[model samples]
Target: MATYSRNRLTQLLPFILSLLLLGLNSGQVQAAPKAELWPLWQPTVATGQSAVPDFKHWENFLSQYVRRYADGLNRVDYASVTPADKAQLKALLEQLSTTDPRGWGPATQKTFWINTYNLAVVSLVLDHYPLDSIRDIRLSFSSLFNGGPWEDKTLSVTGQELSLNDIEHRILRPIWPDRRLHFALNCASVGCPNLATQIYRVETLDQQLDAAEQDFLRNNRAVLWQPGSNTLQLSSIFNWYQVDFAANENQLLDYLQQQGAVSPGILSTPDLKISYDYNWNLNTDS
Candidate 1:
């Protein structure tokens, strides 16, 4: 019996190491994050098949169109975008809105809608570029951003009328049990998490979002300044969506301190100088 036990333990050791390696490499994405930018694409999910999309299709598409849009910013002298491009993109969004991924579940649907909201926002910006922010784009009367109903927006997800805020504030954030998601929904500001190069998947979402929040918080470029400073310069996200974070905590600084790592401690900047920094430039290969 003792010999049998020893042999069984020996067999399990290698199996344990193999599982550790699989976990270390699996679902760990180093690229950018998926946000409210892609309005109609489903998150890249593992179909349990070897041939899975790491977002190559959408990345290629975005690369081409974003470059053209950026060119519009600098040189108005290129081959103008035909209405065809707009029509094609819009058609694709519509397809995403109606797609029913077989064997895929509700979580899949939720992630898909979130991605769609963001994609639609990006398209909206490109349509009205040479502008400042997403807030500049006017939603239809009674749309989510402008004191309107959740639906009836120009952006459609899975064949339903959904406003950007509805997808973000209503379905994905509230109903979903995952908390790491604070990272993926961008409002098109410099302070927001850099939109990921790939789409998000429900299976891999927790890992992806946790990684995103940590990366953004650690980096000084997107979010800066000392909590102890008399003047605190923070991400514009805090300024724009203060209410989302306010109820749980009394103030924004408290939220920062909770997330921040200080040598000694965090100091409340009494009459602290709060500055918002964000660049509305396109986030492409640059």
Candidate 2:
């Protein structure tokens, strides 16, 4: 009888472990910041000549430091950044901080915020250089679980102090509510969508966004299918912001199919299992 009991426990271990992992992943998804609109950002003007701010400095910076590798990742040469280049980055951030984007159109505002988020990430990573991952630079004890400097107020935009979370969750997500924007904002992490070498412009914003989404989806990091196991693996971005993508798992598969990111045959398999994962290693040109 004792031998039978021991065998039963052994048989149940894998199932038990799977349940625990699912719970942990679910907790992380639940812990992701929700989109909450800040009222002050709602106002916008009908017409303005100087609505779009200059991105020449940003363009120059990107040209100098950002490099796109054959692996479909745009990595920054963070270690090679000189003091002068760092000052230029700081100048760009300062320019963005004082510029009031509320007076601009949504397209311009969207582009601005996306660039701001990506730039801020690079800046933060540089400040705490020689780290294995962005997750290593903890702002507080809670950061161990909360993750990096995302929660700390790192930028002042139009007199309103904002964090990376504020830019992504509060302003960008709430204002746009487009899943494609997820591909546009880079977190200086390997699992994140590639940081564009070219600056996002008002004229090409729509095309740029569409291209970003398509590019990310095509990469194995975003979606992978296991034919033998009939399992579908997706980036944790889809899991974290599921509402932005689809209403349910089936809808998500449909969405992927519509994007031409996944093959219909694989998505149509009977009783297919889905999994989510993300890598947080620093996206640096080593």
Candidate 3:
């Protein structure tokens, strides 16, 4: 984001004052003062294959927003983020993804990775809203890029020229190691977790992820818990990554029992719900 200080914003406030007045007079809402000129990202070429991005400044700026304005559990009121805001968010993701993210502090790297993942997912949804899944925006026939996740996506991350999956699966998972990531990584579908309103703060990323998981579980959004039956009903994520969740407990129900407060009786019951109905539709409120 470009730097316009409070003093500068105040100086320019009069110019934008007309926008505010217009909103007051008309029913249409005015955009935030720091709105972007281009709804999509403007590409940068300095993204060296050998270099990583420095996220110190980015971390500081985002932290300020989290501390000063974000509400509990990192949930920003969904109604506030209009479609236009998502367009700006899409652009921001491009900038962050292509930019080298090295030379920053550890916390910054962690937070930046989390934010980038969330933004990338959101951006995909906005352009292809009304789709049934993130798969709708296939890598093979990308409108933006002519490749897929299986192809070589040479982007800089933590000083390495790794693919996007490398950053998410290899680099970030080892650093953060939290289960709540399921919520933050939007797949532009109903089955994927809900997008958090506030940017993930490095200072409280774990807490944020935890709250995110709880949000999903509490609503039976992805997994449902049955106390009487002692059975755990969960999403296909557990079915897909049997290895990730099936270690000591060895089954999906076991993983849920470990993650949930419910005891170990549901696995024996047939009444357990195992539906993983994910919608791949675009995430626009409309």
Candidate 4:
């Protein structure tokens, strides 16, 4: 009897392991990170005069390497980046590190943070080029299971070291709490909104943000409506940051309609099946 029991357990091990893995993944998906403010990043007006850091170098780098293909996604020509341009990018980041934006106006501050986040993402990807996904660039074993480089304190701003998560969740999201900002910040993945070719500026930040949100919503990667099956497929971004977007599914549908992401009929569809998915493939022009 003991020999027979051992054989049965061995045969079921794979299936049991699969079930356990699936449960863990489901929990991970449902538990999205909240936007909690980190007091360290709180802005205070500096007595000394300060100027918004110029992003002309960053803009030039984007103009040279980023291209919007027919697929509607902005792909970075990472492999073709010249060493001179890469050095310029490094210099741009170094310049941003020393500059303090606390004395800057709200518009200038938001523009600075958005551009910095995007620059950091691109820089990180260049450091680990030829990777299939950003998630593959794991710094630690824990990063392999959780966030990749996002949790690492890789960026220095105003003498404070911060990770990508610190910028997005702690600073930007908490300070602004604007859903449109989500489209403005790119994650270097196919699922993320396009990284704008032009650098965000204080003068044109609002218009640029509006355009970014509209462009992403119009793209099939952000929202897909299957009329035949009455199914709504959305990017996992909406699932992860649902609180930022709306209170519930109906309100979410209303918000989507307002953005022209879907038709008004979608709000009335009975037995509507909603599913969320995201592609983690590197947005590269290969």
lDDT of 4 by residue, 93-123 (tens): 8887888887777777888899999998998
What overall lDDT goes with each candidate model? 0.52, 0.84, 0.49, 0.85
Alpha-carbon shift of residue 245 in model 3 (angstroms) = 3.0
Rank all candidate structures by their TM-score, best first, as comma-separated numbers: 4, 2, 1, 3
Candidate 3 lowest-lDDT run of ten: 32-41
Model 2 C-alpha lDDT per residue in residues 91-196, reported as the tens digit of each score:
8787766678887777878888888888888888888998878877778655545666778887888878888999998899999999998999998888899889
Give the per-residue Cα lDDT of candidate 1 at 205.
70
**Model 2: which ten-residue window has the lowest total lDDT?**
21-30
Worst 10 residues of 1 by lDDT: 69-78
- What candidate 4 gets wrong by more than 4 Å, as runs, is 1-30, 46-48
TM-score of each candidate structure, all chains considered together? 0.57, 0.86, 0.56, 0.88
Clash count for candidate 3 is 17
Q: Model 2's lDDT to the true fold? A: 0.84
The number of residue pairs in model 1 that clash at the backbone is: 15
Most accurate candidate by lDDT: 4
Over the stretch 1-286, how does candidate 1's per-residue lDDT look in tens digits?
9999999999998898667544432322222212333324333454532212233344444445433222212112112445666555566666666554322455665666556665666656557765544444545544322422224466654466666656676566555534445567655544456555456777887677777776666666445566555545555555555555565324666666677722113344355565655554334333
- Please write out the lDDT profile of model 3 over residues 1-286, one tens digit for every residue: 3456877888988878557534433321222111122211222343434334343433333333222112122222233445656555544544554565444556666677776665554444445555443444554433123212322343443334544455556656555555555566654445556666566776787788787776666555466665665455566555544444455344655656676734556555666545333333434433
Candidate number with the higher lDDT (2 or 3): 2
> RMSD per prediction, one decimal?
22.1, 8.1, 17.1, 4.5
